[model samples]
Target: MDVRTDEIAEQIYRVSVFVPHAGGGAGFTFNHFLIAGDEPLLFHCGLRKMFPIVSGAIRAIMPTDRIRWLSFGHFEADECGSMNDWLAAAPHAEIMHGVMGCRISIADMADRAPRSLANGEVVDIGGKRIRYIDTPHVPHGWDAGVIYEEVTKTLFCGDLFARLGDGPALTESDIVEPAMIAEDFFNLTSLGPTTAPNIRGLAALKPKTLAIMHGSSFSGDAEGAIHSLADHFEARLRMALR
Candidate 1:
């Protein structure tokens, strides 16, 4: 349970905890992103059981109580597992998620009302502006979505390009190979028709940095990597369907 923090982008910190022999394999990393702004935002709360560790990492950068928004791509243990805990810690913190997620889970699950963002909707938290994109079933969850920071060109892509084991905190090298391997192990991507198209949409953003939920954050040709992932999913889906 060794948690550490790294500044992956300007004013954006990655708080990661690595567990060796995770599930008896190569090990895994549970990561969270903190955007330090006037209204600080935290993406992915980590598992509820690891709330103390996650909060501690955040506190290192800024006061845990200063967080104004707690957001996640979808409702999952690694995403919003500690929503209530965050809200309780930060008295004014508001939950932010896709419209569907709000209607499906956040509305009832969160301690306070959540602010639902429709696809393409943007919100400004101090200096950074985040835009929400609805990507249903692209990487599994029907309520899945991602946030893009307009200024930094950073995509808070949850579970997309996820890799197994303890990868580097940030890499400019190829992540596709490892991500494909992890995808094969988890079989997490949906074969839905919208999968490729959704991936392409994110690619269109040409993100300079990918603030991934698991493993390392990519800082290279994110558009190219995304397109590669789209092609990989399309081919895999075609093969499975056949």
Candidate 2:
């Protein structure tokens, strides 16, 4: 299983690993985002089994030990499976997440003490400023949250735009429809009343690039894509209610 790396934005690198027969043979991609800076930040750590290759890919761009900040959307294996591995490798690295996540799981789960951020809290990691936004159960998981890089206007989409298949590293095309297909296939979202509203709030951020966790990363009309995705979920919720 080889991992591919691409610069989705200025200093933001997308590290992707494709599993040709995942999700009941529908195919899938797991992507991690690394923002290069004085205090380098890595978004997702992939699964624990993916540590070696994922770390190797990260090593190509910078020393694995140089990673100062570790973060993810939630406490899932795919999101922070390599949490301890990263902490062991990078002595200075510390896990960062929303207050609720830390209080609920990360505090006990992480080998090292983790830092919790209040909603809208910004951390300046040298060249980039990352703001943590609480998105509990937006897509799924009560510990769910996301990050936005103020410098590049890039939104780190956890499983929000998740899709099946190995697509390009980045695209300017419409991704909302493909995401909807995956949603139908997996039924991955929580589908609560707040799901669409939580997503619509993110649309207000006006992100320039979307660093998706699965499938392809998207550029161009990110806000439009986000709103469209939200509308789809809203419709789904209404149908379910009816």
* RMSD, every candidate, angstroms: 0.9, 0.7
Estimate, for each residue in 1-242, the C-alpha lDDT of model 2 and write its tens digit: 54799999999999999988796787899999999989999999889999999999999999999999999999899999999999999999999999999999999989998999999999999989999999989789998999999999999999998999888999998799999999989899999899999999999999999999998999999999999999999999999999
| Predicted structure with the largest lDDT when compared to the true one | 2
- Number of clashing pairs, model 1? 0
Model 1 ranges with Cα > 4 A deviation:
none
Show model 2 residue runs off by greater than 4 Å: none
Clashing pairs counted in every model = 0, 0
Instruction: Give the per-residue Cα lDDT of candidate 1 at 210.
Output: 97
lDDT of 1 by residue, 50-150 (tens): 99989988888888999999898889998888889999999999988989999999999898999989899999999999899999986888899999989
What is the TM-score of each predicted model, taking all chains together? 0.98, 0.99
C-alpha lDDT of residue 22 in model 2: 92
